[model samples]
Target: MTGVVRLRAVDIEDLRVVSALLQDAIIPIADMAFLPDAQQFVMLASRFQWEGRAPEDGPTPDDGAEAATRINCAVHFSGVTAVRRRGVDLRQRGAFLSLLALEPSEGALLLRLSGGADIRLEGGAIECRLSDRGDPWPVPARPDHGLD
Candidate 1:
């Protein structure tokens, strides 16, 4: 329970916060689900803990074997009428997607992923929550977007 985060988003401004928190999150293909009957969509993600650290204080393997942290998080979206995928293959087993951003689209919320994959969640309004699930774990490296 290292700095657990619980956030509820109902608008674009709040979603920006959630998006930043979820940036660089890794999600397994099998961990996502959409329940039409419940009008909800859910997914589990391994998110990098990006708070309380300076921009330059990133993991440096060659410096002194520095370690970073990652935590399991659960993301839930209610009032979801439909879920659509683009450039993603659901049949791929053991595949993972890196989340880049979550933004509001024309008639839905878009989850932009790495490798040009995206998920569109269409519904009446945005009602999303992100909660940390368990203890954080050490990871050797931080996610690099090659932005140097």
Candidate 2:
């Protein structure tokens, strides 16, 4: 996790790398903000926070200190040329992110939320910073073992 996990889509495989790099990122709609004039969208994400959480699944009794410390990061997409969506109402702030997809053809990205909301950005550069004011995220290696 030293160098940036940056991937520019010169081919389809590059997009797959970006997809794998963003595995299991949870985004609360309440923390999302989009600036139309600047053509930028930002979202605060809790990485490794898998979907389908139950009330009892929160910080466990014997979990380590990091259990309570969610790794929140800022994800920014800039230079958006156009945007389109369906079943999305930005006013409501109680949804969770289900997916983030990048289109190789148009260099755009799509954000799919839990409530069947799909926001499509036609053109932008995407990057995520692990800390509030730190540099871009470093590339992650795929784990060889499953959740133990």
Candidate 3:
């Protein structure tokens, strides 16, 4: 995938793919929106390029021969009947959060973020799309979870 990344998710399995790609993505508070009239929830994230990473490269960029890359991506979920935010301060426009996962719980889609923050969407069905908005750039380091 040399060009822009585009993905669609209509089910849990497909969402797993999108979730994996967006893991560790950085999202600014000001970049999120919930359009009630449109029944949509959208957010822009600076996502780490995890697709091409080699298994032998280990975790950090320092352990690999290639530098880590990041790109801006826009994600949207349609058919969102309701949205609930927790542990997120919408007033903190400058604050950012790291994406942890996207999972289904009790028929709702949950966007797990760092610092125990979360945004949950409830609706009839899950329809999510992610598209890269700009060129990818090399990042100095990869996100470390201390799992090693």
Candidate 4:
């Protein structure tokens, strides 16, 4: 298909799309130790928290509190674009995305680029390259205990 493919920064609204793509792209390879439901829940929680969504009360401890914290520190850029970079490994199952946040006179923006051909934990860091379309924005990092 031929069309306008513009590259810009990321934003808050893009979180859902990025999260869904990451989850859909990763599930096939995630370790069988985790039930499908658990995997989906984790993915949704991560995406929702990142997108500033209120947490739902669950049987787990402090779930609501943690979700609130994540929502508070969330950040995003304005423009966004994506392209297939390389082949992904489907053997490993985990969601990994590189996000960049920026702020300009217009508004805040967030960019989320998905990697891994299938489902695998690929080591990478968030890259921020200033573009004419957006300015860099800082997102406060929230404290995560690595627990549910």
Q: Any idea what lDDT model 1 has? A: 0.88
Model 3 RMSD to the real structure? 2.5
The global Cα lDDT (0 to 1) of model 4 is 0.27
Most TM-score-accurate candidate: 3
> Which segments of model 4 are wrong by more than 4 Å?
1-45, 48-68, 71-88, 101-140, 143-148
lDDT of 2 by residue, 41-125 (tens): 7777765422212336465322322222224566666666677777866666897775544444457666654456677767645
Q: Please report, as a residue range, the 10-residue window in candidate 2 with the lowest summed lDDT.
A: 61-70
**TM-score of every candidate relative to the true structure:** 0.88, 0.54, 0.91, 0.20
- Across 52-125, the per-residue lDDT of candidate 1 in tens digits comes to 34435555332323357889999999989999999889898589999999989877999999989899999978
Give me the overall lDDT of model 3. 0.89
lDDT of 4 by residue, 1-148 (tens): 1111122223434434444322212122232221233221112112212323334665432343342222111122212222122353434456343322211222222223334222221112222221111222333444343556
TM-score of candidate 4 versus the correct structure, residues matched by position: 0.20
Q: Please tell me which predicted candidate would have the highest lDDT against the true structure.
A: 3
TM-score order of candidates, top first? 3, 1, 2, 4
lDDT of 3 by residue, 1-148 (tens): 3468899999889999999999999999999999999999999999988775454647633465567889999999998989998999899999998999998877789999988989999998869999999789988888889988
Task: Kindly report which residue stretches of model 3 are placed more than 4 angstroms away from their true locations once superposed.
Answer: 53-63
lDDT of 4 at 69: 22
